[model samples]
Structures are given as structure tokens and as C-alpha cells.
Target: MENCKQEFEEVDVVFSKTKHLTKEECTKLQLQDSRLVSEFQASKLEIDAKKNWDLFYKRNETRFFKDRRWTTREFKELVNGGKSCSGKVLMEIGCGVGNLIFPLLEEEPNIFVHACDLSPRAIEFVKNHPSFSSDKINAFVCDITTDEITRQLELSCVDVVTLIFVLSAIHPQKFAICLENIYKLLKPGGIVLFRDYGLYDMAQLRFKAGHKISENFYMRQDGTRSYYFSIEFLRDLFTGAGFNIICNDYVHRRTINKKENLDVPRIFVQGKFQKPS
Candidate 1:
């Protein structure tokens, strides 16, 4: 029957309303009454973005974000879509403390990696990491929105580019420029693997109106910023950047920590886009 088929049909994500952390104080405030960040403060946050992220690593080096071992599984393109991975060039944008970089090397040792971040401290952490090697990785400091990665890397040389949880920190208006830079670094047929916050994610919903910098973008308490993306927006972004979208969809998962008594739903949009061969 139609009803039975619908019930048992495979689904990519089970849609749910945005959730709230049960004990978060922000939930108590009404959006209308809460104040948005002032223009001066917003500008200061943007200007001081690097300093804030550096301080973030200074305060919690190699502790804030854990090793992302799930990257390979989530983005098959990282491992060459099950093909040979030998001699491939991988560039991880916003590679904080080499968390993802080191683990990726351990899992697939044949590929070379170029890891860069806006925070010099973060890049230092990567260079100082025991697994880091000049032969294996070239870690550097770069603010992709303004800096030219081509100076360090030959244009169109990279086979895969990973933008994981990085773009959300940048101003939305600069997204096109940022993607353009990334596009120039990839081989003609190379792919970009992207995963970032999704619109109405719990983290987005957790912010009080006072933290808002713009629609769907907010300033965190620590001075860093976050922007949530809709699937439609991502499609438009990548396609408009001249990429052929392989897949783009919302991924929903829950972060569970029994010791902390935490179970929070998280939403993210992930996609793979390739340049024309």
C-alpha cells in the first residue's frame, strides 16, 4: 500500500524542529526584547577575528575540538571515492591543531596534505605535532578571504579540498571570494568536501538575539562567529562558483555524553562539488 511504502521508504534525514538545551539560560529570553550586537561591536569582532581564534587556541590548544576520525567515512572523496589514494594532494582549510590532518595521515599514509588556518598558533600546533612532517604536510597561516593560497601552492594542483566547519566563521558576503580561491587551487576535476552548520541547528537556536550579527549569523560569547546555511543556499553557492554538485543535503545527528547528561540534536549541511574535467 502507499502508506506502508511511505512508512518504510528510505530517507536521508528525519526532519525535526530546532531543539534547545534544557538548561541553557538563552532559552528564557524573548528575541524581541534581546538586543542585537551594535555595528561598532560587530566591526570589532570581524577585525579581531584572528586574535580571538588565536586566544581560543592559546586557552585550549588541542583540546577544544577532538580528532575528526569520521571525516573519511563522511566524505568518501577523501579516500579517492574508493579508488587509489596514492600521491594525491589534500588541502584542509582551517585545519585547527592538526586534529583532522594527523588522523587522516594515520589512516591513509600515501596522500600528501597541505594544512592551513587563520590562527598562527593553530598552525604552530600542527607543525609541532609528532605526526607532522615536511614531507607529509605543509602547514601555514592563511586567511582565505584575503590571502592568496596560490603563492604557496601551484594553481589547480590539489586533488581534494576539505572545508569542514570553517566557512561558518567567515562573513557571509566573502563566501564567494573564498570559494573562488579554493576553486583556483583544485585540479580541473578535483572535488571540494564541505560540511558546516545548518540553518536552525541547535547551536543557532541557542543564541540570544543580542548575539546576532546578521540573519542566521551570530557572534559567540568568545568573540568567534557562526553562520548557518540552508541546503538551497549551499547549492546556489557551489553551483554559482562553477562547481558541479555531486550531492548536497542536510545531515542530522545527536551529540550524546552520558557523563555530562547531554543529548543535543545537531544539524549540518554536507556536500561534494567538482570542477569540470
Candidate 2:
């Protein structure tokens, strides 16, 4: 009777690796074997970043990226009590085609939005959008890493600055300068809602070795740059810029493709930092 009970209690289990790639396979699949770009070429790309972005907009027009439908759900502060709280001022840095801004305006029509992008063509698209209103949105082309940004918007007048997937496109060295510029424009207690690619995300892993511009930064064939962020680095960056970190965390998920037999892990870092009141 004891032996029979023991046999009945035994269980069989199966275990599988979360990711199937071996070290060599991963290296072969991800790393590019082509020669790295020369310093001169890299410099040219950096200087021509704006031109490249203009070309990008001209190529893809308004159909490249999907509208961010999750902003209201993720950031309730941007909308109070189901509708846009009146008189709130928002600046969407790197506002590409008014994706985020337009949706927010649809929900909260009373808020004023200041939208800027490095690409003039992108700003043009925003201005031409059917929903755009001159009174509701102030759209312009300004590179935040330069002094030109001040000419487009006044300092200390903005209530919230949204940096959605924008900072990663700028050089890491200029990150602090961009943040400082935003800080000068934010009102006391104003918040910056941030989201960007996180370190070791599938996008970064997909970069060829030669495309690597710097540590965790890569240049795509299209001439744009992308940088992956770590939670610690991002927290330090905002805090060092004089903002208090209210929240910082990684959003991770695994995407599976049955046809390709691929399981890709995507990581994004989302944070909210506020200027001291």
C-alpha cells in the first residue's frame, strides 16, 4: 500500500530554455561582420542627422509609426477626470506627426500643446494634419540640444514635457544638455514623462557589430541613431538634471512569432520626473 501511494505521488515535468540561441548562434545572428564606419563618416552622419530625418519623413510621410493610443491610459495626469483638464500646458519634444498630441487633444480639447521636432518636414506634417489647430498647438522645428529651442518657447512656462522615444535618437553626450534645456522651460513642479528603448532590447540585439556607434548606441542603415537605456543610468540622468524621480521602471514583454519560430524580448524604460516646486 505504501509503494502504491509513492508511485501515484510521482509527477513528470518538462523544462525548456526561455531562449534557444547558443552563444555562437546569437553572435552569428545578431552581430554584423562588416567593417565599422570611419570616424570621418561617423562625423558626417552626426552633422547630417537633421537632413537624414528630413529624408525619413519625406519617405515614410505620416504612415511610419502608429499613433500612441496608450498615453491617456498610461498617464492619467495628462488628463484629469476623463477629459483634458482645462488650461494645462504641454510640450511634446520630438513630436513626430502629432501622434501623441492629436490623441490627447481629442480627449482633452482645452489644453495647449507646444510641439517641436528636429525635422522640419515632420513639423510640417503636424501643421498640415486635419485636426491641427493653431490656437491649440504651437508646432515648430527646433533641435533641443541647441540654443535655438529657447527662441520657439519661453522658459518656465510649460507644465509638462513629454519625451516619448525621443531622447534615444540624440547623442548620449548631448543628453544632459537637452535635459537642461527642458528643465529651464518647465514650471516648478512640472513633470517630464519619459519612455525609450531599454538596454539589451531586441532592437539593440539586432544591431550588426559594425553599426555600433558607441557603448549601447547604434546607427541604423537609414542614418538614424538609437541608444538603449538602463534604469540606473536614466534615473541618474534625470536626478542630475535637478528633477526628482517619482517613478522609473522597465516594461518587459516577450513577443513570439510562430512562423519564424522566434521569441523576441522587448524592453522599454518608462519614467516620470518632476521639477521641485
Candidate 3:
């Protein structure tokens, strides 16, 4: 058991190696997704984005996403790169129901977190969790694309920012302003840890006709939107927001469930970007 645990730490198992999609497969999927969502429906989805997310949590609560136990393993900066994590201030944008926040706090109890989500229902879940404490976490509702986070927390106060699976929910047109808001919250030397769905992932390929909002962007049945990212596009995005890229790449993994006869390949873009010191 000890040996297995050691191997888990040594290997980059957070993102398992998986086979890439072939050109023929990509072409077939694209061909099947030729029909696009009507402009009226797309506009409605964008306008009601927050409302839709609130409804999502109201229905599923914290059951939708599993606890993100792999965050520390995937991002060393979260643990101060083997140094003490004491006194570090971190912020998690789009913190849904405290899935990442609670596990992260359990892992490193000394660090404080400021967690925000677009859905007020989600914030309530974070606040009501059994492990929640006012001293350790400040959970709030925020629309990062437009709201001034500095109003709730001071400017340049964050040491690190975690944007896991969050940016993809936003409209592509607002991504610049969203990143700019996050940039304002980080200290000069602070880093942003980003992870999100990548182009041609199984989820993206699964979208059928009338789901596509635009290239690499789609609206789910529940009305929340998602935008797929490529490594080059992600690099340009962070760089354009005045963040210097420390590292950025695509992470591939395979999800398997023998009981259900399910096997799916997942692609994600993960990166670390720093504000110029």
C-alpha cells in the first residue's frame, strides 16, 4: 500500500496518458455537428447564464462534481513547491459548492481562501458545508466578468488564483475582461493555475446538432455554456492579459468504468501563469 502511494506521488497520474483522436474521427464528429444553435437561443443562454447555474446547483447540489483531491498533486504552487504553505492567500473563482475549497483546506489548513461563484445557491453550499469556517474561507457570490472583486476583497491581495474548469463556462467575448478581473486580484508575483476542457475532448465531440454556439463553443441542455481551449489559444489568452506563461500544455486522460462498459478520452488544457513581478 505504501509503495502504491509513493508511485502515485512520483508519477504524473493526475493526467493519464491517452491516445489522441485521429483526423478521420475529428472530421466525422465535425460533420455530424454541422447544425448550429439558433441565435435567439444562444442569446438567451448567455443572458441567463447565472440563473441557469443556480438552477443546476439547486437540483444537484454538491453531488455533481467530485472533490478535487488531485489539485495539490497537479499544481505544486498550491503547496508552495514543497515549502511551507503558511500564511498564503488564495482565491478560487467559480468555486462550485466547495468541492475544491474544502479538500484544499483539509490538505493545507494554514492557508486562507476566498471563494466565489456566480450562483448564490452554490455560495450557500460552500458556506453551509460541515468543514466551513469563517476564519478559513470567505465564500461569496460574484460575476467576475463585470463585478469588481476588489469591492469584496482588497486589490492585489491574492497570492495564487485557481481557475479550474471555470473559464470554459464564460462566453468567449467576455473571456478577456474575466481574465483581466482575475489579473487585478493577484499580487505582482502571484500565479494563476488554470485547467479546462480542451478542443476535441470527448465532451466537445459529443455535442450534437443545434448545440454549437460557435467554433469550439457550445450550450448544454441545461443552458450553461462551455468553450473549449487549445494550448496555443490558452497561452495567447493569459499572455494578452499581462500574465507571463510559466508553463502550458494539453493533458490527456482516459476514463473507464468496466461495469458500465464506458471508456472515454478526455483532453484538458492546464497552465500556470504569473503576473510580472
Sort by lDDT, best first: what order? 3, 1, 2
Q: Is candidate 1 or candidate 3 better by TM-score?
A: 3
Per-prediction backbone clash count: 0, 2, 0
Instruction: Name the TM-score of candidate 3.
Output: 0.90
- Supply the global lDDT for candidate 1: 0.85
Residues 1-277 of candidate 3 have per-residue lDDT tens digits of 1243322222222333333678976785677567888889888898999899999999999899999988998898988877889999999999999989898888789999999999999999998899999999999999998956867888899999999999999999999998898889999999999999887888887787788998889889898989989888887888999999988877876655545666666788888999999
lDDT per residue for candidate 1 within 1-277, as digits (tens), equals: 0234332222235343333435443453347136888999999999999999999999999888989998998888777677889999999999999988898888888999999999999999998998889999999999899747877788998999999999999999999999999999999999999989987787777786689888778999899999999888998999999999998888777655555666677788888999889
Runs off by more than 4 Å, candidate 2: 1-35, 81-84, 256-263
Q: Give the poorly placed runs of model 3, Cα more than 4 Å off.
A: 1-24, 257-262
lDDT tens digits, residue span 159-241, model 2: 99999999999989999999999999999999999988877677877776678777777888899999999888998999999
lDDT of 2 at 66: 89
Model 1 alpha-carbon drift over 4 Å, by segment? 1-34, 256-262
**What are the RMSDs of all candidates, in order?**
6.4, 9.3, 3.4
Point to the candidate with the largest TM-score.
3
lDDT measured at residue 176 in model 2 versus the true structure, 0 to 100: 97
